[model samples]
Structure formats: structure tokens, C-alpha cells
Target: MVIAWEDGHRSSYSGESLRWACPCAECRGEAGSPGRLARVQSLEADELRVQNVALVGQYALQIAFESGHSTGLYTFGLLRSMCDCPECRARKSAT
Candidate 1:
């Protein structure tokens, strides 16, 4: 699945990563737990390359990064809301 940040940057992630990165408390945790990415720093452009993408049934996306980060499940809605591209900015501005 495609994971977009809040800075007009887009990256492809696997279904595994997608599910792992789920913001829902059920998947990650409540609010202070490690969740999927506990000590994971924001991904850099060089590391945004999608190594693999796996679909977990029809619920989540698992994304493996070239940097060996394969624990961030990205949901479809989350992916859409995470779109931080210029297009999104323009759309927001227009709105």
C-alpha cells in the first residue's frame, strides 16, 4: 500500500508493515506502549523504497522498507489521510 506523510512525501509499504503501523489501539497499543514502531525514527527518502508489500487478507497492508523496517501496517483510510503530497496541499488550499 502507499503511505504518505504530512510533508508531501509518499512511500510504498508492504501489507505487513501496513498492519503493524495501524494507529488503532488494538493493533499497536493504547497510547504509550511501543506499538508497531516504538523506537523507529521517521523514514528518510532514501529508505522509503518499498522492499515488499503483503496483503493481510483484506484488513491491512504489510510493508517492508529497504532499510529493513518491516513492522508498520498501513490501513487504507490511514494511507489516504496520510497523503501529504503537493496535490493534497493544493486540494486543502482549494477547499
Candidate 2:
């Protein structure tokens, strides 16, 4: 899926990266465990491809990555809510 930033810049991420970055408890954690990538030593390039994208009802996009992981379903609203640009700005301001 294509993520459009507030700054008018858009980044196209594969389903794998999106899945790896899932906020779900199955892949990550409900109590906010950092993420699966946090445990990986290094990622191979072939692991970063979008295998499939299924629309979960009318709420979320269920993405499968090339690494054979398919669990987190990202909602459109949730994606917008979890935007890193604003969070990054806030972090910079605080620091």
C-alpha cells in the first residue's frame, strides 16, 4: 500500500514491511512489545515483498509478506492514526 505523508511525500512499502510493522499482538504484542524486526539480526532483500493484500471487511487490510508471515490487519484509520511523521516531530520537539 502507498502511504502518503503529511509533507506530501509518499512511500511505497511492500506487504512484508507492513506486516512486520503490524501493531497486532500476534506478531508484536498487545502490551507493546517493540516488534519482530527487533529480534532479527538482518533482513534479506527478498523478504521485503508484498505477497498478498486482503481487505478485512471494510475496516482493515490483511497483508501477507514474502517472509511467509500473515497476521496483522492494518485499518485505514489506524494507519492514519499511527503516522510516524507527527510522532517524529513530537519526539524532536521534546528532545
Candidate 3:
């Protein structure tokens, strides 16, 4: 999906990348536990497919995948940071 920011910047993301970056407690973990994505070696196609996306009260996005994992609330900041555009990549590398 592609998001156009209010500042006229555009960020794009693929389904697989978004799925891999899911920030739910189950996917990102809490406390000292490892997340499911970290333990899993690979993801199936269905797991990476974006089935639906919905806004969460102007703060985040609730994305559902075909694999039935839909717990991640991708906030605007999180999504923006996840952008892989050349500029963003360069900025991250510099930091």
C-alpha cells in the first residue's frame, strides 16, 4: 500500500514487509519473550497477503492478512518508519 503524508511525502510498502513488521504483542512480543515472527523461519504466501486494511480512529491502521493474523495496529508513525523509499532508507542508514 501507498500512503501520502500531509507534508506531500509518499511512502510505499509491500504486503510481505508489512506482515513481517507487524507490531502486535503476539508478533513483536512483550517482556522477555520472543515474537512469533522471530521464531518462524519463513512465511507462507497467505501470511504475507494483505486482505484488508482499516483505519483505527485516526491514529493507526488495522490490517488483516489472508493467514488470519490481524492483531497488529500499525500506527502512522510506525508505518512511516517502515517506508523503504530511497530517501527513508538513506536517512535510516545515516542514523
Best by TM-score: 3
Candidate with better lDDT, 1 vs 2? 2
TM-score of 2: 0.57
Judging by TM-score, tell me the better candidate of 1 and 3. 3
On a 0 to 100 scale, what is the lDDT of residue 95 in model 2? 88
Candidate 2 on 1-95: residue-level lDDT in tens? 67765667554555444655776666565566656666776566655677787889978878777777677788877666545566545875798
Q: How big is the RMSD of model 2?
A: 4.8
Candidate ranking under TM-score, highest first, comes to: 3, 2, 1
Candidate 2 Cα errors over 4 Å, as ranges = 3-17, 30-35, 82-95
Q: How close is candidate 1 to the true structure, as a TM-score?
A: 0.46
- Model 1 lDDT, full chain set: 0.59
> What TM-score does structure 3 among the candidates reach?
0.94
The per-prediction tally of clashing pairs is 21, 0, 0
On the 0 to 100 scale, the lDDT of residue 57 in model 1 is: 77
The Cα error of candidate 3 at residue 95, in Å, is 2.8
- Give the Å error, residue 82, model 1: 1.7
List the RMSD of every prediction in angstroms.
7.3, 4.8, 1.0
Per-residue CA lDDT of model 1 for 46-66, tens digit only, reads 355677778777666666667
Q: By how many angstroms RMSD does model 1 differ from the true structure?
A: 7.3
